[model samples]
Target: MGCQCSKFWVCCWDSEQKGLVVEPPSVENEENSEADDLPAFHEYTIDQLRMATSGFAAENIVSEHGEKAPNVVYKGKLENQRRIAVKRFNKSAWPDARQFLEEARSVGQLRNHRLANLLGCCSEGDERLLVAEFMPNDTLAKHLFHWETQPMKWAMRLRVALYLAQALEYCTSKGRALYHDLNAYRIVFDDDGDPRLSCFGMMKNSRDGKSYSTNLAFTPPEYLRTGRVTPESVMYSFGTLLLDLLSGKHIPPSHALDLIRDRNIQMLTDSCLEGQFSSDDGTELVRLASRCLQYEPRERPNPKSLVAALIPLQKETEVPSHVLMGMPQSGATLPLSPLGEACLRMDLTAIHEILEKLGYKDDEGATTELSFQMWTNQMQETLNSKKKGDVAFRHKDFRAAIECYTQFIDVGTMVSPTVFARRSLCYLMSDMPQEALNDAVQAQVISPIWHIASYLQAVALSALGRENESEVTLKEGSVLEEKKNKTA
Candidate 1:
């Protein structure tokens, strides 16, 4: 395989023999050449990363453990208006900058729907950041064991198992099979409510002095004998994940196997999943898990075989997200904000600055339990006010729309960039430039990447006769709009 100067052959697997075989994917990847046409991995500057993640704010951290852990991950958004997860490695993780770049590139090249798609990397001096698509829905662990509402449905669990196995299958096919730190926490729900293996797992290669966190009880049997992990070890981990899916708890692999041996599948299954799966479904999955947890690593089935075993049990491709968690589909009842519709017109950088000035960032960092509770309590009511504002604004009644949006904002706990932007537009129409500017800034503070917020600010500035400032705002909005369009 080659990419101009980055010419290096990948170590492919012998699918027929299940052995190591060195084969260049250059020829084989010809049909899939579009994969290579993905956006180039940019070497982001540290400042860009800092702004994207709100300077690594404590609230941005999404990892289950240790903020001061050797490596930490934060959720952020790009100037391009993309939601991203930024993994920041401590200086000691890779003392050598060149080595870090090589490893980052190696892992970043592997892309698939089943895995988090790596967008780019940042290697400036000691700071190393790997940016990948952010999953809005939480991990399998949260959905299964520690759900906020209720446990995952049986259909969703079956789908998660199959999707994860297939993700592993895709990685193995790409000739990068040694996935580290594989667990339920590593499998996240994507935008479509599908399970996706985190691309961060790909970084778990044979690097020296690197150790991953996992419960000691679930260590793969082969790794106990040898310090190294082979492809089969990954299958063993996948088995653990299957157990997590079925049991909804971290059961020791040995204990789980014992329970399976007794055919106590009922004891092994999650009580929440009771009456959802048939005996045949339970048996098929348990049998597959048993094979995966084989003591002899060589006897363990490969990822491809695991995919085959799980596919037969797969559910419908597009299950509603609300159904998975026993929630109802409520989007139509509550509009997603007109600002979301005018997203392509805002200045992203100016919005970020507005947020930074207002002591807020994005959801992961800026939002808190109290704020969320307030939103949850008054969401429908807030929608009613915004809806009234929308109706008035549509009828060219700027005064009425401003009064409606003001009431929604005066609640002080509710957040809606659209309400702020709409109010600012009304203020401008009423020849109230100062009020328009204040509301425009508030809109940006709540939703930093929204383009329309900045556009409104520019209109307000020009009305106030701040020509130079208005020109700068217009240029920033133009740049943000161009980026949005290109990505679109």
Candidate 2:
């Protein structure tokens, strides 16, 4: 039997066995050498995953497209206080559980600083989920396209392109060459605000081959006919990303190429990025993008080539990503409002006083609450439970307060955001941050604009070691409080 051989592996005929034989590949590679240094990949039980995601709550959703997306991505915190991004596949996504595990574990073996590496996966019955390190800063699409404070700087854009190219190169070297739906949304920024390629795109979504979520015209031309993605197709998508960084818009590759051909660099560039980069630098990026957008997939530059081309184009290499993006650093302390200060200090006395002052004033406008006029036994029991919980909370008896509040909530006789908020604080005092966070979210659901609920959530999130989410929630609470004061 004739057999083939490669640099990594060998196949040969075994005369003794009278059959072809394949030998395991050599493990003498640097990537394999660093395996022990990487975080251990976990096989999470469905229960653990559910608890992490608060039973797949809607508020935890962090995907760009929300629930309408094919596979919804959620933000969650593990019992270990580590934040994670969970991608839950639809029921129809992975009918073959074994195949799903194989793919997830294969991707999990890969660890890179430029990628949001997969930490674990859960596949039990109809449920399928992938857990990865959570990125605190928002996605590239939000910063580049729908920016609120300021558009992404030219230096940051260059860094993003280079980092993403390096991510692709690393994945290719690890034998995972194809990436699906490589777009700005697929790029997320970490706590340091540095861009990283999402690892989720590396897994082949078995859902009927509709991979590209962008305009059909912008999709790789070959995918239109084949209904499949190849490594070169990934390059084509990268070209589109380059165009996006240039224009700060979703320009179809064909149109972008036409603009490049016409020497309309000025017109193609983002208005916000004006005066940032020299025309020479812009021309060089445009030239590279044009090659990646070539009609023939074979002509497209490989990931290594893309990395080589992008490395020289990088700017502000010495400046940290968070500083360049004007985002608050991990150690940076924001001025805290009175409520935030109390929460930070865990001054239960101050928090209790503040809640007492708030005193159901926001309750009068609550439309979700059941009418309190009913004299049924259930209503009386609900009121009595809340009264007892309040007394326990006042006395700092958090355990009893939690129990009483649970009874009141489970009875479903009335909707009291105040009761939920009190229970949340009690849970915080009880050292049950996850349950506290859940109750705080439930409070927000009952009263959408209540600042106290947001404040409690911030405290719970902080206890859970999710500082980024905590800061955002704290800011939201301050805003809502200000709005309420103005209305008052």
lDDT of 2 by residue, 1-488 (tens): 01112210111112112221232232222454433444689999988877666677676788755445768898876655467899988888888889899989999988888889899899999989999999978899999988888889999999999889888888888899989889999999998898999999988665565577666888898999898899999999999999999899988787777765555555678888867886556655766677688789987778776666666778889999998888988556556678878986768679978887776777775535467554778778877888898888878888999999899889876778888888888888778999998888777666656788878988898888888778777776776777777789
Please give each candidate's TM-score.
0.65, 0.78
Q: Pick by TM-score: which candidate is best?
A: 2
Q: Write model 1 residue lDDT over 1-488, tens digit each, in one string.
A: 01111110011101223432232232222325434434666678888777666567665688754643567888875544355899887665666778878878887877676778787889887777889888867888888888877788778888888778777777788888988878887888765566788888777522463434677678787787776678888889988988888898899999998875555555677877767776556656666777778898987888777766676687654667556756434222222123332322333334323433432222333332354554574766775787787778766688998888887777776566666766786787688988987787666656655556666767677777776566555544554555556677
Clash totals, every prediction:
3, 0
Candidate 2 lDDT score at position 27: 20
Model 2, CA-based lDDT: 0.79
